[model samples]
Target: MLPALSTLAAPAPALSTANTGFVLICSALVMLMTPALAFFYGGMVRVKSTLNMLMMSFISIGIVTVLWVLYGFSIAFGTDFGSVVGWSGEYVGLSGIGLTELWDGYTIPVYVFAVFQLMFAVITPALISGALADRVKFTAWALFVALWATVVYFPVAHWVWGAGGWLFEMGVIDFAGGTAVHVNAGAAALGVIWVIGRRIGFGKDPMRPHSLPLVMLGAGLLWFGWFGFNAGSWLGNDDGVGAVMFVNTQVATAAAMLAWLAYEKIRHGAFTTLGAASGAVAGLVAITPAGGSCSPLGALAIGAIAGVLCAMAVGLKYRFGYDDSLDVVGVHLVGGVAGSLLVGFFATGGVQSEARGLFYGGGLEQLGKQAIGVFSVLAYSLVVSALLALVLDRTMGMRVDEEVEISGIDQDEHAETAYDFSGAGGGAGSRRAVPAPDGLPATPGGPASAGRPAPDSTGTDNATGTAPHPKVDA
Candidate 1:
């Protein structure tokens, strides 16, 4: 009884207010990424499906936050079970933690850690929405998010980031979710799309982004928030590791953007705004895992390589007849793979861990470990996500009726349109007449005619303009 009483009196770990504040800010930034992603994906889709695209991402915030509090935090960061999953009765509903209790060795409160991780869980599933835009039933998608988070996301997170998990135990360095978040989400995207099939007019129609400005805005916000996403994974700035990661993140993103533009100019004969935005995202994805271990130079290489690779990969969907509506497979999955593997070749051996890449005399050992981590997560996520999607499709019906898809998913699913052009003309789809200058008559489908249809929303080459080919548009 005395020993028990003494143990009960043991002091809790101290918390750092500075680190706490930093993590809270970082959490906000990551939370913003979900909505930012919505805009990015929203603008890339047709005007009719825009609201649906936004809702698909926004709903994850609601769904995942609830789940994380209930059991997700535990299943991910709880006591490891067989190095596959995790559990803790205390973590159920987040009721057992004290306000002052710190997260294991970290200086921040466990609550802060939990919430930060919760943001990660929220955005991961949101990333898959872009792949299935314009066809899936909203109810089916919501249900899929809940199940996938439980069965796919929670377990994979444990395997990669949890203490005593197999991948973590095996010395695979993910640093900031190259494998856990991006690869996990990307592979899941592929799996679910395979089950659900393609959009009705995938190849034949002029599927272009409705608002390049919105895409740019979202891309800018993502860039802003990603600083917190990458640097905050270090959990604190007490060490210089977070600082190094910050620098690497910027360098890699710039390099990737340039590399993508260069590839576009060389291959397609035009550098496009879409390419710029997609290139930046590719860089961000590539640097997610490798940034902590790499120097600025190494990050530049990783970003550039990923940019070109992902740009090339986006065209494969057309060749193979898989309609990845928004290039989730090309950018996230391929970029995630590029970033995770490049860590093996580019790790500096000084930051994050003692492990070195082949260039630093670390031999092929680290690269091999990275490959194991990369493909294992990819395989698990791809297979399990497909099964979950299949189950949902068979039971609840994953897709909306063909009529709803052709008409537009926004009105069917959400009963709202992103843009109301009614004030401009007769109705949302009607074109307004532009007043002709002086005595000049407005030419049909001409620049002066408001009745002229807008250029293909994605900035693709169309009747009115010559832009980049739609095949490479994200």
Candidate 2:
């Protein structure tokens, strides 16, 4: 009977080609975020390993994109087996479900939804790499990511998004993946830092960012792509509803940016570019779960709240001795929770299709559901992520050998360099970098230049440079 009904299902039955086009565009926009993430994270690392860090995000695109087609979608959105997870039957091997899919009355091509979701899969785990930067064997890290996707990410995703998943059955309202994406990834980053341990010379040295503009650039791209993330959740531009989400996304992001900078200036005595970027991310994270649920004003409040809370999260490691080096845990996990629970309190005023939070007098029911969603993802992610880290550590080791640790991964792992402006010259490699476009000699550690190159094992030029990029260690 199921097979007979499946044959009767029409192609593109629930939506039109026009709607599929919109979803396709949105999915593409989300895919761009991985590269944007590359710039955001790449610029933060020492020049020696910039490519290596950026590669992490890129590899995710390669690995998870394939996995999603194979069974990731099944594991996540398939029919529920009992009450805990799905049966992998909704669209086996991407069969039966094609150009027509009814995610609701508003449907699109199944492939459109599949491709759109694949981008999310690629990015979530990639975010964790920032925590254990500048160390860990590449091969070990690669295998670890694969294992992690199946063991940790898939099951949790099932619980949150799958029809049969317990969280979904309980009516947890995570419109854009608060628990599934941000909280899950953020908590896992914490687990990674725990198992991988600190970077070499962590506290002993200044450990400053190598670039600021790169950070800003990344933030800019993420900001642009986020329109797709928030607005596209509706699957089309067919109505004022999606337009509202788009506007709310921008307003909330701006509010969060302001809040982050305000707090930082008051606490640190300077308005930092990095802080601004991170604040934008915090706003984006906070609004994600609440995007479909909040009014513009409520979104503004949510963004502001997230910024302040996440700003405080950055200081957690210093106070508690846990090394969430990049604060993935601090910002995403914390901000996502703030948005997730708070939405229950503020879902009033033009948010009917949305759930109401307790603050608006909805009482404890929604809040309790939100809390359960957060803790379940947090607990499951933390435990599974820790086990993966341990497996990598126990089997092939986590951190690289001590001597390799001292050298950058680009040199040791990739056997390459980021910049080669000098090219082989006069039978000896010239260590001198090119002059600035303004005809000024590049200065190491200079304001206009990437941080000065550290002396190499052989004292050659271009050895251990801190290229200006957008990365901030927590």
| Every model: Cα RMSD to truth | 5.3, 6.8
What TM-score against the true fold does each predicted structure earn? 0.90, 0.86
Model 2, global lDDT: 0.75
Tens digits of per-residue lDDT, candidate 1, 221-297, equal 99999998999999987989999999999999999999988988888777788889999999999999999998999
**Residues 258-308, candidate 2, lDDT per residue (tens digit)?**
998888777656577788888998999899888777788988999999998
How close to the true structure is residue 405 of candidate 2, measured as C-alpha lDDT? 66
The count of residue-pair clashes in candidate 2 stands at 14
User: After TM-score superposition, what is the CA distance of residue 287 in candidate 2 from its true location, in Å?
Assistant: 0.6
- Cα displacement (angstroms), candidate 1, residue 222, comes to 0.5
- Give the least accurate 10-residue stretch of model 1, judged by summed lDDT: 457-466
- Separately for all candidates shown, the number of backbone clashes (residues 3 or more apart, or on different chains) is 3, 14
